[model samples]
Target: MTTPVLFIHGLCLHASSWDPWIQLFRDAGYDPHAPGWPGDGATVEASRQHPDAIGDHGIDDVVEHFAGVIDRLPSPPILIGHSFGGMIAQKLLGQDRALAAIAIDAAQIKGVLPVPLSALRATLPVFRNPANLHRAVSLTAEQFRFAFANTVSEQESDELHERWTIPAPGKPLFEAATANFDPHSPAKVATDNQTRGPLLLIASGKDHTVPESVTRATLKQYRHSEAVTDLVTFPDRAHSLTIDSGWREVADTCLTWLKQQSL
Candidate 1:
């Protein structure tokens, strides 16, 4: 049977952003699918037209949504997730729901203590207003440039923003921010699952939204687990490494790692 692969996108980018990955994974002898988060419309324009449908969902809600997707698969598939999607992949993998997972520039989960100034600034569009906690928030082109496309050229960044950007629920950001304080925070991941599948955490050195410091701290969270866990850093890449022109390099790196694990 062909191995299955699921691509999970992070906030502000439509699930369609995984289109290139889906095709690439398929060509690599895997069956790949990229499903939108709950409340996401069939298309980016549809989601934008009705922002209310994309608001109010929280971290746990997203985790559960993807878990349901996995339940219908022929078998537990490999997972590749970016940003908040990375966090969701970790949560599912801890539950022993996948064969393996790759989390690229994942958001900070509970117990990850370093919140850099850049990260704070990147998420300021949502945190600046308490009301945003329950609403859907959209990033302006400039905000997207700073937070995700900083390492890329201005023209390319603007084009990407127009192509993939969408309104994202603000609840996950709020939950992650207060996770350390909430003992039962939805942002918590089962990092101690020794029997869970192998996990690879990818970090981009110049990612303002999810700084390398955050990814390193996240790696520490898995130290108690004896399961296969590895970290790879792209020293000059930014948060857009997974979507920008450099995406193929990151994807190829992931493929190489999976082969190393004999997966």
Candidate 2:
């Protein structure tokens, strides 16, 4: 049977942003799918026009949403996720719901201690308002440039913002921000699962939203697990490494990693 792959997109980017990856993975003989988060509209424009539909969803809600998707698959899939989607991928993988997982510039999970100033600034648009926790928020192109496309050219950043950005729930951001304090935080992943499938975390050094230090901290969370856990760094890339002009390079790296794992 052909191995299945599921691509999970992060906040601000639409599920269609994975179109290129889906096609590429398909050509590589894998069945790939990219599903939107719960409450996402059918299209980016539609999502923009109806932000309420995308608001109020927290981290647990998203985890259950993707878990349902996994339940319907013929077999466990190899998960590849970017940003918030990366965190979701890790959660599902920890639950042993995937064959394997690759988390790219993943959001901070429970037990991750370093909250870099850049990460705080990247998420400030949402955290600025206490009420935003229950609302959907959209980033200005400037904020997008700072948080995601900082490593890319100005023109490319603007174009990417226009093409792929959408409003996303602030709940998950708030939840993640306070995860370390909450003993039962939804951001918690079963990092100690000794029998789970392999996990590869891809961190971008220039990422403002999830810095390399944060990824390194996340790696330490799995120190107790004998299961395969690996980390790779792209020293000059930013969070947009998955969707910017350099996206193919990141995707190719993931493909190569999978091959190395014999998946």
lDDT of 2 at 181: 92
| Model 1, residue 20: C-alpha shift (Å) | 0.9
TM-score, cand. 2 = 0.99
lDDT of each: 0.95, 0.94
Candidate 2, residues 111-174: lDDT per residue as tens digits? 9999999999999999999998889999999999999999899999999999999999999999
In model 1, the Cα lDDT at residue 3 comes to: 86
Residue 113 accuracy (lDDT) in model 1: 99
Tens-place lDDT digits, model 1, residues 19-129 = 888888888889999999989999989989989999999998999899999999998999999999999999999999999999999999999999999999999999999
Local distance difference test, candidate 1: 0.95
Candidate 2 residue spans exceeding 4 A from truth: none
| Residue-level error in angstroms, candidate 1, position 148 | 0.2
